[model samples]
Target: MLLTLAKEIGFSHAAAVDPSSLKAQQEVRELCAADRCGHYGRNWSCPPYAGELTAAQKQLARCTEGVLVQTTGNLADEFDIEGIGRLMQLHSRRFATLARQARLLYPKVLPLSAGPCTVCRHCTCPTRPCRFPQKRLSSMEAFGLMVGDVCRAAGLPYSDGSKTMTFTSCILIMQ
Candidate 1:
């Protein structure tokens, strides 16, 4: 059912992995500490706010496998940061919606988005409890998983060129 949904969504690739295969929490911490997202320590779903990667791994451990999924959007050039951002935002919302539907189908499913949890237009993540805890999700990068590596493992092409914007997201199915 999940695989079918992924295909319906235009995902280029999808595969399942044991949650244990994910990297360690400390590694995620170090990556976050580097402040790659700028929101590393600022957002509730990033670094200090998201807690250790170990915690993420532990939570994932309860799940039998995680389904990695990717979506690619064509762009005109590298300077189209705005275009890329908009495309990502669109994909993020679509991913979340699909995740919710997935949860209805598989009650134990847990979604981890491609980037920081973007449930709120402007997150009060640092200052307040998440507006939608059940819907909020963390990005794969936040867990210290080099996304390109993961995509390659899933048999997906991570970089087509500067003319394409690729977004990856995942869900852990505990059943």
Candidate 2:
């Protein structure tokens, strides 16, 4: 069922990642604090707001299996940052929706999106508390995941050099 959904959603690659392959929590925290992605403190799901990476890692460790999903979209050029962002959000929402359904089959499913959680147009996540914790998902980078490594391990191409936009998302299922 999940595979079918991945295909339907235009995901070029989809496979389950081993939870054991995740990186150390401290390493993740360092990367988040570095704020290279620029979303580190700006988004609710990013660092400085999402809680300690150690805690996140511990939480994810409970999961045994995870699925990596990707979607590739064409863009005019590299300057299309807005276009890429929009495409990513579109895929992110779709990924979350599918993840919700997957949770029905696997009660302990944890979704890790391609980017920060965008459950609300204007997130009130950290100010108070996550408005929808159950539906929210962290990014692979947040967990110190070397996305390219994981993608290669899962037999998925991390890039195609098409000068276009591509989005990837993942969900961990605790079996």
Error of 2 at 65 (Å): 1.9
> Which residue pairs overlap in candidate 1's backbone?
25-53, 25-54
Instruction: Look at candidate 1 and tell me the lDDT of residue 25.
Output: 44
The residue ranges of model 1 lying beyond 4 angstroms of the native Cα positions read: 18-20
TM-score of each: 0.87, 0.86
- For candidate 2, write residues 25-71 as lDDT tens digits: 56666877887777777777777777676777787778887778987
- On lDDT, the leading prediction is 2
- What tens-digit string does per-residue lDDT give for candidate 1 at 3-41? 778778767667765566656446556776888677765
Model 1: lDDT equals 0.74
Residue 54 lDDT, candidate 1, scale 0-100: 69
